[model samples]
Target: MNETIQTILNRRSIRAYESRQIDEHELQEILLAGEYAPTAMGQQPWHFTVLQNPDLIEKLQTLCKASFLNSDNASLREIATREDFQVFYNAPTLVIISGNSKAIAPLQDCVLSMANMLLAATSLGIGSCWVHSPMMVYGSADGAASLSNIGIDFPKGYEPYAAAVFGYSAQPLPKAGPRNSDTVTMIR
Candidate 1:
């Protein structure tokens, strides 16, 4: 199989990671991959925030857990209360993809960038996982406040649309799970 195809196929959502940080060069390359992702209408309105600060990561995790615990949803609260729960799986790096909330197509653009970053990480022997929970915190008023606490500022009228944690895996990669064939349809 082609290397690109193989990378896509082999990509997995890694949850556990070693404390070791990914090399700065590799992180830059991954961000470059995200920057090169195709955008709709050529609107490259996305913003990438690469966070490597352990203290900031821990603060964000604390905020996320507090937000989850205060949720109206019981399941989220329960999970947040779990002794072993971690918002970013203790990964050494957090890459947040955000864009103008008022844009006509911000989410799609941000997600594509996220996909590119994931594939790039996989190709570089790094592990990654798409994390949606942070969006909840980012969208909330309190959560938005915490952004400034970490010295991260979104472009005016922009907010985090997606995020992922990247680092060296602490365990072996799991085998790819079965795909849902029924979801596809032949139109031709």
Candidate 2:
């Protein structure tokens, strides 16, 4: 298989990471990949928030944990109750993708962007995990307000649709899980 296909197959959702931050140049390349993702009507109505500060990342994690604890989902509450739970898995960098509310397909556009970023990160030997808890926390009005109070502000009319953490993997790359062959259908 070609390199792109190989990378796609090799990419996995990393859950553990090292303390060192990824290089600036590599991060820019990943962000560029996200920027190039296909957008609906070429609107490209997406904003990327890169959080590298340790304090801010911790604060956001705390907020997300609180949200989970208060959630009605028992699984979420159980996870939040763990004392060592870190929402971003202690990755040195967190990227939050947001989309303009007026865009034709904001959520889809943002998700595509996230997928590009994840692939890019994997290609660069960086570990990445798609984090959904942040969206769970920041999707609400109160959560947005709390984020604003902490100086993490999104562009006006833009709402977070996806988030992920990137860093050097502390553990060995995991093997790909077995795939089910029955999921696909032939249309032609």
Candidate 3:
């Protein structure tokens, strides 16, 4: 298989990460890849917020945990109760993608951008996991205030759609699980 295909197959949602941050050059490449993702009507109505400060990441994690604890979803509450739980898996870098609310398909555009970034990170031998807690937390009024207090200011009319963490893996990559055979159908 070609390198791109190999990279896609090898990519996994990494949950544990080393303390060291990813290289700046590699991060730039990943963000560039995100920028190139397909957008609705070429609006490219998305904003990338990269958070590398450890203090800020810790604060965001705390906020996410608190939000999760208050969630009605038992799964979220259970996860939040874990003593070792870290919303971003303790990754050194977090990237939040926000989309213009007026765009044709803001959520889809932002999600595609995130997918590109994840693939790019995997190609660079970096681990990445799409963490949804940020979006969940940021959607609430309290969470919005907390995010603002921490200096995360999205462009006016833009709302966060996706968030992910990137870093070097602390453990060996796990083997891919078996694929579900009935999920796709060929129209031709």
Candidate 4:
């Protein structure tokens, strides 16, 4: 199989990470990969906010958990209060992908960029996980204030669509699960 194909096949969402941070060059490469992702109508309406400060990461996780607990969703509140939960999985870096609120297919564009970043991280032997709780938290007023404090700014109408954590794996990741072929359809 081709190298790119192999990378895609082997990619996994890593939850446990070492305390060490990824190299600056590797992080740059991953960001560049996201920047090069194809967008609808060539409109790259996404902003990637990379946070490497451990203090900020901890603060964000705390804010996110608190926001989750305040939500009306009972399940989310329960999960947020769990002892084992860390929104960013203790990774040394967090990348928040936000999109222009008025752009066509902004969410899709952000997702494509995140996918590219994930693949790039995999190819570089870096562990990464897609995080959705930040998106949930950022939608709230207090979360917006926290983001502003952390220097994550969005244009008046922009919003966070996705987030990810990156670092070196602390343990070997589990194997990929069996594919569900039934989810696909063919017309040919």
Q: Can you write out model 4's per-residue Cα lDDT over 35-64, one digit (the tens) per residue?
A: 999998999998888989898888788888
lDDT of 3: 0.93
Each candidate's lDDT (Cα)? 0.90, 0.94, 0.93, 0.90
Candidate 3 lDDT over 1-188, as tens digits, reads: 99999999999999999999899999999999999999999999999999999999998888898889888899999998998998888899999999999999999999999999999999999999999988988876687778999888899999999999999999789899999889988899
Please state the error at residue 61 of candidate 3 in Å.
Answer: 0.6
Residue runs of model 4 more than 4 Å from their true location after superposition: none
Q: Candidate 4, 118: how far from true, in Å? A: 0.3
Q: Model 1 compared with the native: what TM-score? A: 0.95
1 or 2, greater by lDDT: 2
C-alpha RMSD between model 2 and the true structure: 0.9
Return whichever of 1 and 3 wins on lDDT.
3
**TM-score on alpha carbons, each prediction:** 0.95, 0.97, 0.97, 0.93
List ranges where model 2 is wrong by over 4 Å.
none
Superposed Cα deviation of residue 93, candidate 2 (Å):
0.4
Candidate 1 lDDT, 1-188, residue by residue in tens:
99999999999999999999999999999999998988878888898988899998888888788789878899999999889989899999999998987777899999999999999999999999998877888866678888678677778888899899999998789899999878978899
- lDDT of model 2 at residue 14? 93
